[model samples]
Target: MSLENTRHPAGPGLDELVPSRYALRVGDIDVLVVSDGILSLPTKMLAHDADPAVRAAWLKDMFLPPEMVDWALNVVVVRSGDRTILVDAGWGADPNLPRAGRLAQRLEAAGIDLGSVTDVVLTHMHMDHIGGLLVDGIKDRLRPDLRIHVAAAEVEFWASPDFSRTSMPPGFPDALRTAAKRFLNEYRSQLRLFEEKCEVAPGVVATRTGGHTPGHSVVRLASGGDRLTFAGDAVFTVGFEHPDWHNGFEHFPEESARVRVRLLRELAETGELLVATHMPFPSVGHVAVAGDVFRWIPAIWDY
Candidate 1:
């Protein structure tokens, strides 16, 4: 699949609509990469105990430019037999965040509408990923018909009355308290939680991969002997380069590392395409195990 960005009225200070990236098809599923803009952060901000040489090597390997790293929010849309499943909603219209709020238009560009989405698979409840779930009209609001699929632990944690006020770890912000609270308040009733591993549908299975959040998950799509995994935040930017690097945004840093290490090994050993929400554009690639380390080999497609 190819991405084409058409011009649309800027939401606030933006000049034009941003383009999207497409990962084409995997057997019966069509994966559309929707761009929700990007976030710029310093390398050190990702990890507190970063080793200088390892960090530099990771940056070099990923072809990351110096100074800052900009991560694009790549939302995944899966069109299988009869399912129009959206992996995660992008950040919605926020005046302060001009780069975001383009998922709706991007979806239209990919020939999809909010109403056409049959199921929503939320990996976790991060602001940038879940902000677009609600229709934010200036005065009135519109809610789409979507049966949200989430990890039972995640739903329970975020929906708990005390979750919002609970203090987060060092790297996390207090404002996450408020945002998560709002998300739960608005969508709790609409959410359907699943256990460790379950078939969300015919060929779509929800895999248990946590640590980024209490109940973060990765999705597996299998058809005709082919499989693809939609990994939410299981792996971060540095992890793409240095699989050992632990991202600070994780709810449980050590647990996240353990899961990623094992998951990456399995993915490489299987030689299947993996889609990440923040692993460059299109974010679909295969893993190559090099001795004890791993490399991300991006899928080639005609633009």
Candidate 2:
């Protein structure tokens, strides 16, 4: 049902130490999870509103560093009915972020060509989720008529994105603004704006869930009774134990919390597979309700 290779470093001459892709099946659809690499961010961004001591304790308990966290950027590729859908693009370019932005080379290594992607379903326009599309020569390599699906509200919000409630690091707000504006100008013609939900393929659906951003959304894939939801930024690693904790990048922290709790509950009840953007690499897992909070149960790799 799933295939992943994480043995040791690559044989030889490969820049990456290990394979960065995970493959699985949701009924008839083939899904591949690729790592765009990791982002090193401040630990406080994980929960800006939480008590500092408590937050630090939580990180300590998890054996994570108190000052910084390496958040994983997981992107997915889906194949269904002649359609190749890219769920989200990873980081593109940042002089300070050399560790991230490996989506393009990794995709090629996985044998997927840029021109074969029929559609790009953006969870939202946040740089990490859309920046790979901005990389040099990326546009020329992609099919000229490739369709990009995004929530209408998301596109509208970025026209003049308001970061009033967010709590990002010093240079993030301005950087985000620039990337979003550039993406809009370059891809306006390719955008296929949807009001609420859109079907990217036969069994893949993208539904707008306004919280993190006005049009942030999650992709749900269902086929022959198998289900998996790619919850893009709707939930983080700490969210299960403390769904109320507000992540700094959230434009509407309170609303983001509400969305996280709702989505977590729904996943728990359904007992379906869950993959999130910022969870550890190979983020495939299941959700379970534990007393008052939820729990993440990582699925064993099929290998």
Candidate 3:
């Protein structure tokens, strides 16, 4: 239901109107899943190559609307030892996506101060992943010495980016390019470019798995006997069942599919907790091997 039509107790802040964050632990690390808000987009973007009938059936089975969908935007905060790391900033202010760009306010509501963050591990340079840092005065709030970790290949790719395969709505290509360029130009001095992987904290490592983008990466957290993965945009709600489906926004659809399958297989084999950028709120779940396809087993809320 639309928020306008749905009833709720009076509240001034968005976080109070509805839940915006979830806290959990991984070995010795603390993780908080925060909502940047949501994006409403055409359902065709979900799988541009799928047969209309098949895609329709899948959406119907999932109980999602056939024409449009509200995609969740989740940003993760990881705290380990003396460092607090931000994983993928949300779209700070996209004129087209008014519902999103709530990460700054949401982070504050979650008690995560911007200046307190020591590092940022980016999965890619997608607008939704880096636009929050570009928000007005965001740089002032962040410590000048903050380290931003991202794949060197990702930086290189955006410099001469190609969008021959994507099937986005009008204006998205230009918007994405502009946002990525602006972010890099603004944060070039703070970037800690890595070729393959980099240890962001005591227990967090971001590994490049070029598929969705040349520099797309996933962060893995391990400590003691517990493990979790912040998959960024590498995984999604529909990825488990249709790993081969080409998301319209994927730069390399085939490679993205391969990466998705491989990641799903590894997560299933290891039985690690998985959190992704576009899954439902508090996207904490486990991957399971269900015959030939994978299944998403959401974790029971600790509360």
RMSD in angstroms, all models?
A: 4.3, 2.3, 4.7
* lDDT tens digits, residue span 1-303, model 2: 123332333335444656588889999999999999999999999999999999999999999998989999999999998999999999986777888998987877676778999999999999999999999899999999899999999999999899999999999999899999999999999999999999989999999999999999999999999999999999999999999999999999989999999999999999999999999988999999977699999999886
Give me the runs in candidate 3 sitting further than 4 Å from their true place. 1-14
Whole-model lDDT, model 2: 0.92
Candidate 3 structure quality by residue, lDDT tens digits, 165-254: 999999899989999999988999999999998999898999999999999999999999999999988887888889889998999999
The alpha-carbon deviation from the true structure for residue 299 of candidate 2, after best TM-score superposition, in angstroms, is: 0.4
Question: Clashes in model 3: which pairs?
Answer: none
Native-referenced Cα lDDT, model 3: 0.89
Q: Order of candidates by TM-score, top first?
A: 2, 3, 1
* Candidate 1 lDDT by residue in tens digits, 1-303: 222332342245434433464656666666677787776666664554578676777677668765677777888877776777888887777786576667876666555556667788888887777888754651122235567888888877665423332233454465455567777788778788888976766788887787777788998988877889888888765675556566756667777778888888899988888888777777778998777677888888656
Quote model 1's TM-score: 0.85
4: Cα error in model 1, Å: 12
Estimate the overall C-alpha local distance difference test score of candidate 1: 0.71
Best by TM-score: 2
Question: Where is model 1 more than 4 Å wrong at Cα?
Answer: 1-19, 60-66, 138-145, 159-172
